[model samples]
Target: MDVIVIETPQLGDRSYLVHDGVVALVIDPQRDTDRVEAAALEAGVTITHVAETHLHNDYVTGGYDLAQAHGAEYLVNAADPVSFEREPVTDGQIVQIGAFRVTVVATPGHTHTHVSYIVSDGTTEAVFSGGSLLYGSVGRTDLVAAIDTVGLTHDQYASVRKLVHEAQHDAALFPTHGFGSFCSSGPATGAGSSTIGEQITTNHALTDADEEHFVATLIANLTAYPSYYAHMAPANMQGPGPADLEVPESLDAAELTRRLADGEWVVDLRNRVAFSSGHLQGAVSFEYGNGSNFTTYLGWVLPWDEKLTLVGTHADVEDAIRDLSRIGIDSPDAAIGTEPRALAPDAPVASYPRVGWAELARDHAAGDVLLDARRTDEFADGHLIGAVNVPLHEILSRMDEIPAGTIWVHCGSGYRAGVAASLLQRAGRDVVHVDASFADVESAGMPMAEKAV
Candidate 1:
């Protein structure tokens, strides 16, 4: 059997297509089913089974729709209260598709009903540990509910041990999350590939035999996840339809200006440097590129169900749509161009000054507000003495809380700070983008804050 991996790097997740040269089984598919369908076609295999480890808390699942489209059996946990029909799978249940045998194992941690699958060809075995056993860490246990977090943490510990005991030491380990996904308890080890044997000695859950320490460490390390995650589970339970990848209607200069005037979200998809140099007066920067996390940040900050207008080139707009579609945002209005000036010829553009850590330290001002756009934990670790900690995701809701002044926003690497700076600038605050790495703060001669004893 051959395993094909379909990676969604934007969301830090993977979907797999496992085949026995004739029939295939797909696991944890994203809303876009076309990619999986294309993979099956290229491999000359018919999809006969599709399985979901659990109701996801990050993106809408395409399992229900994909099964219907291809006339495949949809396998979902028996305990999940989903609205669609599915082949109810339980712990220890074995299924056969062509020459491959699949075993379902209960591994509740990421969610109450989460499970993992072990697929074998009688000679070689591969384990699909969706959000359970990750590269180094395990999936976060708090997404289900705050009340169940402690219990789920313990469950996660047992689940990881269970997986290690059940799967062969040399079995190929494939996880749906932990590739830079927030679902991971902490930073993933960034391993491209691993096996059960490799993870045995390296994975934190395995190396740290103390269950209480493991649980406490995971809970303490859990930072703020995307606000958009709140909607994913409900949408998945109701059964999401196929993703609508159609390009949104194009907006002319007048329409773009009107939308801006009306205070709609007109996201400018350019690099941070270009965005800070020039953009539409009301357009906020959400740069689109590889490893940008464009969808995650945008989805987290923007109000749900609001009219969104994307401004960028055709390629950027198309790519943004696909990324947003994975998170259930579809049919957004679009304005294609190299910059805001070209998109809105008749309109006046806005620009902000970009500075570095050294410059900020050199031009010391008493009244200026230093806004730290990193997460809360990051700020607590160490930051500039007086920098206000307003994470990029919370910039919108907590706008009024930021002290009024010439706001100099900075993040760990300035990517998030760029987004925060544009939003502040659009909100009529005198903003400057500190486009420098936070690592240089001390070397640049900036004063560091001390932690509370």
Candidate 2:
């Protein structure tokens, strides 16, 4: 059997297409199905099965629609309380696809009704351990609130142990999370595939601690996830409609101004340097690039109920829409490609001053307000001694709490700090962006503090 890993780096999830020369099976597909179909076509096999590990809480699953399009059987756990029709798979049940044998194993931890599939051709075997057992870590157990977190962590432990015992010693370990995915409990030691035997010795969840200790560590490590996550499970349960990938209509200056006046979101998808140089008043900056963390920060910070407008080049807008769609944000009200000055000729252009780590260190020592725009847990890990924590997501709501003065902002990296700087500047606060690596904080002879236990 041949396995093709389909990676969605923006959301840090993986889908797999496995084939045995005659037929193919797709597991845990995202909203976009073209890639899965392309994989099957490239393999010169027809897709006969599409399986979902669980009702995903991070992104909309395209399994149902993809199955319908290909005239294939859609498989999901029978215990999942989903509204759509599917072939209910149960534990210990094996299904044959061409020369491959697929067995379902119940692994309920990431969600109340999650399962993993073991695929074998009677010689070589692989486990599609979706969100249960990652390479060196495991999926976060707090996503489902109906089940107590303690109970779910125990379940995760048991399920992973079972997978370790039941799979072939040489079985390839393929998981849907843990490649820079927020769903993971933490980062994997290595960002690649591992074997069942390797995980038995190396996976921290399996090797390092007992159940109680593991539970506590996992719970304590989970940081703030995207606000958009609240919308994914319900949409996936009901089954999401096929996404419309078309860019929205172009908006002129008047429409853009009117939307901004009405409290609509106007996101500028450009590099931080370009955004800091000149941008439309009130537009937030989210740079478009690989490994940019665009979707996570945008989803965490944007108002869920409000309509959104985007300003960028045609390619940037298209890429932004695609990234947003992965998090279930399918449409924007409008997009503008013309220069910001052209759109709002008379509107005042805004920019924020970017400072290096050494300058920020000096200002911090001399009593200037330093705002750390990182996640709560990140701030707790290690931060400048006098810096105040105002995570970028909570900045708008907690604006009044900020002390009156010129505020200097920084994040683990400059991306979020740049975003925070733009928001602060737009709010009429005198702001300086500490646009350097937070790693430099310790090296710059700046005093650091860990949250008191």
Q: lDDT (CA) for every model shown?
A: 0.91, 0.85
TM-scores for all candidates: the values are 0.98, 0.96
Q: Model 1 TM-score?
A: 0.98
User: What is the total number of backbone clashes in candidate 2?
Assistant: 0
Error of 2 at 161 (Å): 0.6
lDDT of 1 by residue, 1-453 (tens): 999999999999999999999999999999999999999999999999999998998898988899999999999999999998889999999999999999999999999999999999999999999999999889999998899999999999999899889999999999999987888886577588999999899898888889999889989899999999999999999888988787777888899989988898999898989989988898899999957899899999889989899888889999899899888898898988876777788777899999998779877589999999999999999988988899998888899999988999999988999999999988899998999988878888889989866
Candidate 1 residue 216 C-alpha distance from true site, Å: 1.5
Misplaced by over 4 Å in model 1 are none
Q: Can you list the residue pairs that collide in candidate 2?
A: none
Q: Which candidate is the best by TM-score?
A: 1
For residues 1-453, could you state the per-residue lDDT of candidate 2 as single tens digits?
A: 999999998888899999999899999998888888888888899999999998887888999889888889999899888898889999999999999999999998888789999999999999999899998988988887835778898889889998888899799999998887778886565367799999888887888667888887888777777777888898898877777778878887778877666656789998888888788878888888858988888888877756778888888898788878877887876565647788777566777778888887666545467899999888888888888999999998999998878899999889999989988877889888888998877888888986678
Q: For model 2, what is the alpha-carbon lDDT of residue 451?
A: 65
Best by lDDT: 1
